[model samples]
Target: MNYTAEAPAVWDPEAFTDAEDCLLCADQCVVRAQHYFVKGMIEIPVIGGDETFSWGVWVSISRDSFSRAADLWDTPGRESEKPSFGWLTTDLPVYPATTLNLKTYVHTRPVGERPFVELEPTDHPLAVEQRTGISLDRVREIAAAVLHAGEDAQR
Candidate 1:
């Protein structure tokens, strides 16, 4: 029942630098500390299995939502806050269609966990998987298709 898959590194170029305009860490990103974002778990249930297949992904959220999340970040019961609107900023290459800018509702989890990002119900395969879960075979297929494509180019 191992579910600790490696989350992809942030792909946005602005996050690559030590510049003052942006901040990108293991679990959060901020621009001018105003255009805020946080990495969250996009979990697709595994059909007939014990664990979910997940993508640790980032989303662009509003200033207000960001502020509220920061305020309650260390506080207990932070999970009670309403979900906030966000745009899926991560581009998952395994999908046939582009996965960026998709609508999402970001749910804050308790302290010590990433937020859960719920994709809007749509016909897109990724969104559908988020809503209805995916088969384990499909997860393997996706992993095989995209996981190693850029390794050589990076070096």
Candidate 2:
């Protein structure tokens, strides 16, 4: 299912204990107080086949992680890059019970405006399950609960 943020919310960094873990990390990570637009899961069907798989989706505006990635993307003689948005998705499991399967990508504009470019493949799953035909409201509920759970864990 497709998602679009009507009124995005900022996730306070202080709400999470591991907010600093993203810093200097090799993978693209989301920071606190960043505007998260969409968060949900989708089931991907194999083309021309009956096989199907699930993936969790997270989309947000660029923050510290994006800046770090852009800085790293710059070379001695190459043009500087500025990413404005980020998209992260869980990978299809090789097995149904695989863990820590996710990937990240970025773009110069909101995902609603332009496509995102792959920054790097990641393996940090949010422990969310993929469900088909879920409503946007339900997705938001799940996202909120996940964030709240993180905050509670930090406290």
Per model, state how many residue pairs clash. Answer: 0, 1
**lDDT tens digits, residue span 1-155, model 1:** 11222322344464546667777677767765556787898899889987888888888889898888888989999999999999988778778898888899999999998999999999988899888888888878876665565565476
Which candidate leads the pack in TM-score? Answer: 1
Badly placed stretches (over 4 Å) of model 1 are 1-16
Deviation in angstroms for 47 in model 1? 1.0
Q: Stretches of candidate 2 above 4 Å error? A: 1-56, 59-62, 65-101, 109-155
Candidate 1 backbone overlaps, count = 0
TM-score of each: 0.86, 0.25
Indicate the worst ten consecutive residues by lDDT in candidate 1.
1-10
